[model samples]
Target: MGKWNAKGLELAQKLEGVTDEKAIKKLATETMQEIIDACPGEGSIKRPRAALRKAIESVYPSLNAEDNYPQGYYRTSEGKGKGERYEHLALWYLTTNIDRWSVEGDEGRQQYWGNLPTLEKTEPKPQQTKQQKPKQKETVMSQLNLDLDTETQQALDFALKQSGLEEKEFISRAIAYYAKSIANRHEVDFATIPTEKLLNDSSLAKLPGRAEELTRRAVRAISIYNDDIAPENSERWAITQSAIARLTGGRAKSIQKALEDYQGMIADHHAKYELNNYSNRKSGGRTIEDTINIAEL
Candidate 1:
């Protein structure tokens, strides 16, 4: 692109605040026509210069007048290395409008050959090393409990379907396994009624687990105790006490008693057990230190 010349600069400076594109184009066209008219001959460099000036003026109104060469033209491959094609004309047309650039910065300004960088290429960063997770020990029950990823779960479902167990039986066993898993969450050993007991024992057939039996008892105890002691007190707290009673055999109820009474005792018993479990767990085996020492002796 050829740099904007004296005539183009002067025209651009003339129309600084004229924002309308059509108006600017019109002004540019008229100014170029005037410059051409002023020039002596039709095919003179003066005519092309005037046209170039007009285009620059139209596009870049706020061009720096102090600079000697604010814009320039270069040759294009089209038109057999032409003098100045329509594309060059369009460049002049677009570049002339300084308003096309940002208001605060020189982002729209074209980089010139003088400012081209000669810096070396930067090397890429090394890839990060990912640490492998430690391998977990697998037991039969552990494998059974291993979170069969969703894919494995589907496979297990299919495998279970192929097994001779009925769908209902499968569900029962699954539920029992699930309950056992929950019961094992804190400690490896805690006195707990077996799933077989729940299924076979008439008294416990309806009970899900010790905790559940406790919960039922707690709820029932709270309901009853609230009536006997204070109707407005905490039912949930009473229920918790009932759980403790059931586990310790300290509550004044038999399993043969009303459902509410039995449920209360179970609740009281479980609550106390849970509290002790929590304390023992937090002490990091210190809670049982004396017992361990005695056993060792």
Candidate 2:
């Protein structure tokens, strides 16, 4: 009962109402075979076997009593000698140990058998020194106040109710996600753009707004998709098609189609750009400029 591993617990369960010695021995044999099969390696076999042996010896102490035969006599003998006799002894040990543990008082049981035969060998956890202890993370707290229009407030409420998130959590997450997306987008843009044009590009000013719009569209698409397939619950998007249409200014089907089209475009673009040294030019193909120069020549 005290954190017995699967095999040990199983043997114990099978032993219940099994008063016959033959049945117990058979169960012991089967359990030993299973343990051996589970752990075949020499290094891995010792602890489980020892635990099982201890269990059996505890229940039937007579088995552990000194044999009249000489120590090396059984090893040299052919049939049903020491190795064969104790081949399945581990299981009997486990069964007997389980029985003994069951009868003991609570304190005695805890003291003796509480941590026995988890089946896997467990090493003692090393004590953590003052220097080894993990340093606590310092959190900087900030406050924000937002004034919303009635329509915006209603939309925020609807989103919060549908998403099953607290207003503070949702707002914090939204801000964090938006900030991360903007930062990533800016980094990509900086890397890709020519240095001279980078400062002069008027379109750079609109990147944040474009990113926000794309982010909103993505979030809306995900929300619609979740609602369409999700199980019926308070958390599920339970809004009617007409309500969805009104909110999104398009039918659910149209929104889904648009999302699919957008995803396909993204996939196509990635596939197109992912290849190394990709170009429209064929091997040994002449450029239009080269043909024009030849004609001039």
What is the alpha-carbon lDDT for the whole of candidate 1?
A: 0.37
Worst 10 residues of 1 by lDDT: 128-137
Global lDDT of each candidate: 0.37, 0.39
Instruction: Give one digit per residue, the lDDT tens place, for model 2 in 1-297.
Output: 322244565565566566454455556644543443355343565677666655544443332324553221111111365432322222322331223312223254354445542222234335542223223101211234356678986786566546544345556777886785576466343435442343235445344333223323433443443345434322222122212222323323343333443555444433543411122122463222222111111
* Model 2 vs. true fold: TM: 0.20
Give per-residue CA lDDT, model 1, range 1-297, as digits (tens): 344465566566555666444445444544443333343333453446655645563554332333343323222223364342222222333321222211211222233222333222233223331111112223332655656688976776564445434434555576786785565454321135443343235433223334345434334444444345433322212222222332222222222233444545545644643432222221222212221221111
